[model samples]
Target: MAAASGTRPEHMAPAEVFYDGTEAKKYTSSSRIIDVQAQMAHRCIELMALPPGHRCFILDIGCGSGLSGEALSSAGHAWVGTDISADMLTVGLARGTPGDTLLSDMGQGLPFRTGSFDGAISVSAVQWLCYATQKSHQPYRRIRAFFASLYRCLKRGARAALQIYPENAAHLEMLSAAAAKAGFRGGLVVDFPNSTKAKKYYLCLVAGSGERDDSAAAATSAAGAAAGAAADSSSSSASDGDLKHSDAAMEATDGMGSAMTSSGLVVAMGRRSSSDFEKRRRSRAQDRVGAHAPARKEWVLRKKEQRRAKGLPTRSDSKYTGRRRPDRIT
Candidate 1:
């Protein structure tokens, strides 16, 4: 749809130009659009994998008219929504959604502190970040900045599900690459992957610095180190195996580029869960399982406890606990 009487949709309008005044009113009052937004937002929240009855702080990006926020609010989630259109936020205020709303361009990056939000959901909003309405607006940089900022602000182990409408394979890859580079672990999960009309592309993301990811990384690193050690120890097939392992890791990234075929865009009507993510994750973890360090001997812990009971100092309960022994170590 055109932003103004003669505006072309290809040259997308700024959020204010397209969603303010009459446009905002029309959108807020439209039953069809509202329903669609509600459904998509609900799906995005589901993809976040929050436990049932769990109330969390959520971020609603491109929260036009607060339709998406309404769903989150109804679910008893506290949210802070942002949009580039003040008119939309005004409508949201009128509706009395249970959350704060801000007029801000997401392309410039979110303003929340690191680890501020438990999760994030953007319904029909991320795609807008792909369009540059101003001369200074570079889509790649903007998208990267937004995802990078988002990655930092989410709590460890938190997920974000972005429901985006990419114009083409190139656009989709562009967004996915940026997310991956920003250290997200999940991928483009297409709900109803076989149905063109019903298919939804959800960029499901888990913060890469989370404990799960750290363990995965440590596993992969251990695998590589073990492979190196084997290569040095044996002068037979081990060397070839190490070369194959390195080659496979390098080859894995080849498909991350803009190599998706046009036919690949035609999603059929079939909903599939993100099982592949789990599969690959487990595979990586298994690859290094054999190299896992042996558990610490029980005697080490026993001795530490013995020393503590005798009023001697031992390492704090945890690395960060820093609970020093009382005065004389007792």
Candidate 2:
């Protein structure tokens, strides 16, 4: 199916109504979309701070057709997925996936017992809960219920990464505020904050502790320092290693600014600052300096070249091409 133009249905209806039979099938089968969801799920789990050990049970909320759960399964982690659409779950079950699947509306709350999973992940799911299509459905009340239930479902100190696509800053605030009211002590982590297509926001939540947020920042700083140290070490090595090491260091610093670490801290992501925009404006200004004003003769020649390229009639370039002709001598 072709993507919708101008307007998105996701912004309007409840997920269950929007993701019916063919829509669910098409969503599950689209390779491009599948890859995107997989990448997002990987990032979401990574932000969860799950330990690197034996397989741990994870919750995949709004796991449309088990796409996100597939990512968890590939990583050797066991997952139980829940979605509002029976059609989506049907598609997931048809795949013979390893993870258990549930048919449930996230706004109503998850069905699991308290401390049921090691960690939880939801990709492109939570924000849907922000809309209320029916009078019976209250956005704030529903979000609070889901977050509180999710908070109780995870083991203490276990983080939940909810990848959300808020329509605007207000929607984001609504979701975050609901989570906070539900006793979740973490904040939103935005990846690639300056880019439009590549940006992602994960609502990282800690079940019982407030210090996880600080710990996340500390972890990011430490990772950056380690990367910096390695670059310095590589500088002392062979000349060829310096370039590679410096690149690695720069990448580490970039990642540090991107999001949280794996099982480390629950740091909130920062937005692009005014200074960043100023730097970009300065670079753009520098690039355009002397670009607008061209030598009169050179300007005529360049315009002539452009016209010729377009196969348009062009005046022959001459010193007098753009100047008034001198008065004819008597």
TM-score for predicted model 1 compared with the true structure: 0.63
- Please give the range of 10 consecutive residues that has the lowest summed lDDT in model 1: 237-246
Clashing pairs in 1: 193-268, 194-267, 194-268, 194-269, 195-268, 195-269
Root-mean-square deviation (CA) per prediction:
21.0, 15.1
Model 2 regions more than 4 Å off: 1-3, 210-330
Q: Pick out the ten consecutive residues of candidate 2 with the lowest summed lDDT.
A: 236-245
Tens-digit lDDT string for candidate 2 (59-159): 99988789899899999999999998898899888988789988898888899999889889998778777688788988889988998899889887778
lDDT of 1 by residue, 282-303 (tens): 8779656532222333445667
Candidate 2 has a TM-score of: 0.66
Candidate 1, residue 195: Cα displacement in angstroms equals 2.5
Model 1 misplacement above 4 A: 1-10, 209-330
